[model samples]
Target: MGEALRTIAFKVKTASCGGTQCVNSFGDEQLAVDMLANNLLFEALKHSHFCKYACSEEIPELQDMGGP
Candidate 1:
């Protein structure tokens, strides 16, 4: 197939270091863990359908669903 797709794997760290006890170096206060999971789930599926490569914390394995 001529279409091209790619996957980006992001490392996620869960810790008590947030807000007053937050230890995140970046100091991001955008999305919460639960919301992040929900959003990631939908985002992953939305992109995975035709992605040549798919990966995420929601998925345990790399998926090849399309032509490179």
Candidate 2:
């Protein structure tokens, strides 16, 4: 999580976190950085082989990660 956040911070400093991508489930504007962070964390959890499910403000649906 820390590493992922660090990556986001770097992106922010680099101006790589672009403008809004879309509106989230809460009707809030979702920025590119938000998507990036969400994807980063999701990928990390997916590769861990222990996270069975996940949900977030960006993707409110419960996702099956194929973990055991």
Candidate 3:
């Protein structure tokens, strides 16, 4: 969990800019840091064998991690 949080923090800190503003599924302006954080969390959860599920405010549904 600590490593996952650290990875998310690192991605947010290093997110790039200069792209045209884009709207997300929520119809809101998508920020680089927001996208990076989402991706980092998804990846972390996907790779965590101990995680049985995950849910985020950014996503509408739950993610199954395939854990026993």
Candidate 4:
């Protein structure tokens, strides 16, 4: 997706076996990029697509749940 939210910049990134999203807070991009170390990946996970699997910044531990 092309940046639509007035607060955050969303980039759709796909994987070989799943999908993921990279969200950067807009209007306050710099700070948001830095706050990632403190925010929970799952919390940012809402309202987005319910992909077959979700991964944090770099595809941490994940289990396949088949397909939905």
Candidate 5:
């Protein structure tokens, strides 16, 4: 998670935060950075092998990650 966040922080510092936009699950305007951060964290947790479920502001529903 730390690594993912760090990567996202670096991206935010080096790139434009408004590169893209879309509507999230909650119908809120989502930016590219927002999606990137969410995907980063989700991948981090999924690969960590301990996260069975996750939820975020961008996706306000619990997601199953095939954990046992």
Candidate 6:
């Protein structure tokens, strides 16, 4: 989990993707960092197999991490 988080953080800092032109759930301009962080975290959690469910402020509901 730490490695995954670190990887995503690094990507967010270096990647050129993402923008504020798009809107988020709150109707606010979506920041690149926010989008990158959410996507990276979701992917990490989905594949980690360390938890049955994962939740985040960015997501609207819990994510079920199926069996490995």
TM-score of each: 0.30, 0.80, 0.59, 0.25, 0.79, 0.61
Candidate 4 C-alpha lDDT tens digits along 2-42 = 22332233321221323224444333223333333323343
Clashing pairs in 4: none
Q: Which stretches of candidate 3 lie over 4 Å from their true place?
A: 1-3, 16-29
lDDT per residue (tens digit) for residues 12-65 in model 3: 677675563567667777776776677677777678777787776566488886
Tens digits of lDDT, candidate 1, 8-46: 123135433253422233443433453355345546655
Q: Compute the lDDT of residue 9 as modeled in candidate 6.
A: 71
Query: Which window of ten consecutive residues has the lowest lDDT sum in model 3?
Result: 17-26
Candidates 3 and 4 compared by TM-score, better number: 3
Off by over 4 Å in 2: 1-3, 16-18
Q: What value of lDDT does candidate 4 attain over all alpha carbons? A: 0.35
TM-score of 6: 0.61
Instruction: State the displacement of the C-alpha of residue 51, model 4, in Å, after optimal TM-score superposition.
Output: 1.7
Instruction: Return the top candidate by lDDT.
Output: 5
Q: How does residue 50 of candidate 5 score in lDDT?
A: 88
Between candidates 2 and 6, the lDDT winner: 2
**How accurate locally, in lDDT, is each candidate?**
0.43, 0.85, 0.71, 0.35, 0.86, 0.72
Query: Which scores greater on lDDT, model 4 or model 6?
Result: 6
Clashing pairs in 6: none
lDDT per residue, candidate 2, 1-68, as tens digits? Answer: 66877887787677654578999989999888888888988987887889899999999999987788
lDDT of model 3, residue 59: 64
Worst 10 residues of 1 by lDDT: 2-11
lDDT of 4 at 37: 30
Q: Model 5: runs farther than 4 Å from truth? A: none
* Each model's Cα RMSD: 10.7, 2.1, 2.7, 12.7, 1.8, 3.1
Separate clash counts for every candidate = 4, 0, 0, 0, 0, 0
Model 4 Cα shift for residue 59 (angstroms): 5.1
Q: What would the per-residue lDDT of candidate 6 be over residues 1-68, giving only the tens digit for each residue?
A: 68768987787778765557477566777667776788777777777777677666566687787634
